[model samples]
Target chain A: MTDALVLLVVVPIAASLFPVALGGRFERIGWFVAAAMGLVHLGLSATVAAQVLESGVISYAVGGFEPPFGIELVADGVSAPLLVLVSLSTLGVLAYARRAGPHSNAFYSELALLTAGISGVFATADVFNLYVFLEITGLATYALVASGRSPRAALASLKYLFVGTIGASLYLLGVGYLYIMTGTLNMADLTGAVASVGYTSPAILTSFGLIVTGLLVKVAVFPLHTWQPGAYAESPDTVSAYISALVSTAAAYALVRIIYAVYTTKFLDEISLAGDALVALASVSIVVGAVLAVMQSDLKRMLAYSSVSQFGLVVAAIGLANETALVGAVVHLVGHAVMKGGLFLTVGVFATGLGVRTVEDFAGLAAKAPISSAAFAVLAFSMVGIPPAVGFVGKWNIVVGAVEAGAWSVAAVVVVSTLLTLAYFGRVIERMYFTAPEPEADAVSTDGGNDAVEVSFGMRAVVVVSAVAAVVLGVLGSDLITVIQPALEVYF
Target chain B: MIDLLTTHYNYIASILLFGIGLYVVMGSPNLVKKIIGMNIFQVGIFLFFVTTGYVDGGAPPVVGHGEETFVSPLPHVLILTAIVVGVSLTAVALALVIRIYDGYGSLDEDVIKEVQVDD
Candidate 1:
């Protein structure tokens, strides 16, 4: 059982290498092996979750060495849920990629490596190891984004790499500061040392600032988010969907861990200004991102900006630092991943067949591809926080939590942002269903060539599954809250 | 002031190097120079960590007969890993730069942006 921890992190990494090693001679074998590895990872994560729920936290020291000396992997309720989310989403995305037809085998291999790296970020107990995993994930993501056919794809990827490297460098600098202060790299040990040293030390504060800023950049929070819309819009559809689901979510999770696990509530209380600063940035991000999203003409770019808005909501909830708000943050994290991933994948299907990118291109899509269109409508409504959708549940918790924390401004922002969200996506829905297609262009194209714009069964399956999951997760909101409560308690 | 300098020499150097790196990454018009700046920045971090592990006048962490009084080996190991990650990033960034050069025939971001807009 303990060895399972090592296997969970190691298997995907090892498998990622195998496909590359085999090269083109065994492409089918590579895909099979990659898909199998994803399934196995999902199974292992599920097992880890079950054990974590039953047995409290699970700690595995690498090579049988003790912590504060050797690298350790720890899984608490919080990590377990994220681990499961990462694995399951990887599996779904891998399936979608396979069905989408032959991409470079090397790309899938890198995707697997990225998945491994993200899982390692969730699982690793050493701060420096987290930095290493972050690098791996960043490298893999740049490659994935640059794999797109568009010339702009390379430019977007380059920008992402440049900003992302800065973020990574800042993170390393922060880790260096923490190491200098504590003389240890282990997260658990650093937590005690940080508390003992107190938060007033210039070194600790510098580290906190660097780490939070680096993570904010990674999360694409507000001003640092300039790289994201381009990266999200230009990447290959499957790549965009996978990254949309996980990258910022993982960064947000790391931010929460740094605040709650590494620094603790006591340390945060001392740095009252830091917490308030984060909340303020998150507030600005929500309003700014929502406004920018409304102005976007490109459908994918619109959703990308909307993600910036959604991430702000999640970060603000985390910054609030109450149990209810933390729960809201966690739920929002999961909710956004499913809804955004589904929406992106659906858009991918549309773009693949219809050659659509802008909002106007989607006119009358609901009539052309009813099932995919309907799925998009459900997801769009969910993104707007409409009832019986995961987005609604997430927003409801966040709003309720804000009120409980007596953060009336945040509560009001949440309501206003929700309305803004509905306006943008509602406009998209109207364009898809209500607007008429140009008759002259239609007459020039006989056989109703537009009617062939429907997605394949497999792609439709992925959309339906995620769409259903989004609704079911919301419908079972109480159950999710119950499960997430234990995780949220650790923060409060 | 001298005592503070002596005690925190590595810290001062780390900040100085970090600043230099930031200057190049942000200020340099050349793409390759920015990458070089990134490398210098990473080296600064590596140095900070290595220095943190040094107990004053302690021996190297080569375990031997009766040489158990050495500085910690952990930060050294950690920096080695960082070096590998840094090198990997440099390789990828350089590859992207090459691609960008191919696309725009220029390495300056402003020039590239101008060309892209013209296109």
Candidate 2:
């Protein structure tokens, strides 16, 4: 079992080295190599997920040593689906990047590195290992952000690096506290040790505070999310879509792990402040992110702000700390990745193909780029929580879960946040479907001057497929729950 | 209070370094200094981890022919890995700063951001 787990991370990382070696002779060999690795990683993850589902949890210690000593890779109900999710998204990004690319050998190398880092995040059972993978992911993201080769991209990436480093440092400091108190780095050992030390100890509380702060910054929760918009807006199109879908999704998943796996629900029960503080922050993020998204004229920046709000819903569900709410968190997580990733891809198509970047520039996009505009609308509706879409189902479960948990205010915020989401996307939808394309205005648009690159069939295909998947996963949400149910039972 | 201060001086020093790094990172407008601040912050975390691995009267984590008390080696190994990561992160950040400087001809955050808005 550890074989597949190790292979899933090692494949992409090891393959990334090949592009530089081979690309010296063949210019676009990076494309073929990355695609091959992505395909292999996807197959390995599917096999691993199937094995985990059929049997129970599988924990394989690396280097033939047992846990609490050697690092362990676990593929249980919790991480198996996420393994599938990150792999699928990586492959989808590869497909999209083939058409719309920075097209450098180094570009695919960073993509491969990012894929390896995320899979490691999804599977590692050691807390310090998680920090290592987090930095790896941050480094890849910083490089990829600068790959756009613009001054703005460089500055944005620099800002991202500064903020991301501080966040990771805070997390390392928290791990230091955990080690000092418990003298263990393994997640399983942490639970018993944390309980023995008492959850209310000032040291334990401070560690929890630092850990959550670092994760929230990574998660891009409201006020701490300053780096997100610039990085997303200024990066090359494919990088924006890829990181938007997975970076925060992986970080949010880590937050779930910390809350439930490392700290445990009992910890939250002992000290409600730990949970309450997160809930308050999430509630503010939901409103503030939506309001900010509404103000952004740039489509990609608007989508970036929308992510702040969407992740707020996920974190709120996490803070509720109920079984159903947690389920909603996972569902919304999967749903948001597909929908938001698809939206960014569509924006990429518009930006590269037609020089459209602003919302106004998207006037009557239906007539110009019909399939992608339709794809955009479908994903937007899903994001708005329309019925039978994955988005609606995730929101339904979360609202019901919040009510069941008697967090009346949280339930209210969840409901209101849905309307706020529609408010921002509604105008874009209206303009796409109803408004006619303005006849070639000469107004100084804010889009960076490089425009009208050829859009390939693979780029459009990836967008359509993700849009369809959002609807399909919505219908199959209940079956997906059955798969995660076993892990959830143990987790809660 | 006197005993607490005397006994925990290493911890207090680490905290002071952390606070100074935080202030420089948040308060300064210079991009390169901010990166230096980031490095200082990581140094604080590394110091904290190393301090936790210290023992009052214990041998280093190497084997003798007999039973012996030793400070834990796990945190040392963990800190080594973390320091590598910190180095790589600094490399990436400095690379970006170089590019930004090349593009805007200024290393000031305020000037670079203002230029981005104007463009």
Best by DockQ: 2
Q: Give me the runs in candidate 1 sitting further than 4 Å from their true place.
A: A440-454, B1-7, B65-69
Tens-place lDDT per residue, model 1, A216-283, is: 99999999999999999988888889999999888888898888888887776778888788888999
RMSD of 1: 2.4
lDDT of 2 by residue, B5-60 (tens): 99999999898889988889999999899988888888988988888888888788
The window of 10 residues in a row where model 2 chain A has the poorest summed lDDT is A440-449
In model 2, where do residues sit more than 4 Å from their true spots? Answer: A442-452, B65-67
lDDT (Cα, 0-100) at A423 in candidate 2: 89
Give lDDT: candidate 1, residue A299: 86
What is candidate 1's lDDT per residue for B82-104, written digit by digit as tens? 88888888898888888888888
In the range A1-492, model 2's lDDT, one tens digit per residue, is: 449988988999999898988988999999999989988998999988889988868777888888988888888876888888888888888888887788999999999999999989888888999999999899999999999988889988888888888998898899889989998888988888999999999999989999999989999998999999999999988999889999998899889888788899999998998788889999999999999999999999999999999999999999988999899898898899999999999899888777778888877779878999889989999998998999998899899999999999999998888898898899998888898876653133324536646789989999999999999999999988887768767767
RMSD of 2: 1.6
Q: What is the C-alpha lDDT of each candidate?
A: 0.85, 0.89
